[model samples]
Target: MLGAVERPQAWPSFLHQVGVIELGKDRIEGSRLLVVASQANRGATFIAQSVTKQGLMRSYVQNGNPPWLFEFFVNESSNL
Candidate 1:
């Protein structure tokens, strides 16, 4: 899980609800510093493990068993 100190100060609550397993500062070839987020439900068993990276926006999400902190899975991988 992203450490409280490392998490964005103004991050959306919904994103937090989705739950994070890890968030790190790594270098992705073309980028200076990339933030990779390992989601709580994005395990090897899940399907549609999707990752999208556009500019400063990078996201990883997967579709699994049930809803998270909301009625529906946040950042549903179905959209991927």
Candidate 2:
């Protein structure tokens, strides 16, 4: 569960929120907003995707390659 203040209005905020979720960070904001804005399962999925995309972007910047292709590969591999 997340707090209200922890919920994000933009992409970066969303990403940060997800990081908090992953790291088990506490938030003073209510989780209601996150729940109301996005249903439980959807919100979780959105957070996961956002985090994965951010990870891919960071990796791309570090390696100087297309992140999307690598993202696709990783996603496919994960499914298998």
Q: How close is candidate 1 to the true structure, as a TM-score?
A: 0.16
Error of 2 at 25 (Å): 49
Candidate 1 residues 1-80, lDDT tens each? Answer: 23333465545553654243232223234433234444544542233332222321232323334445243345545544
Best by lDDT: 2
**What C-alpha lDDT, on a 0 to 100 scale, does residue 25 get in candidate 2?**
39
Whole-model lDDT, candidate 2? 0.51
| lDDT (10s digit) by residue, model 2, range 5-50 | 3544445646755676655534544433334433324434554575
For candidate 1, what is the total of clashing residue pairs? 1
RMSD of each: 14.7, 12.5
**Whole-model alpha-carbon lDDT for candidate 1:** 0.39
- What TM-score do all the candidates reach, one by one? 0.16, 0.20
The total of clashing pairs for model 2 equals: 6
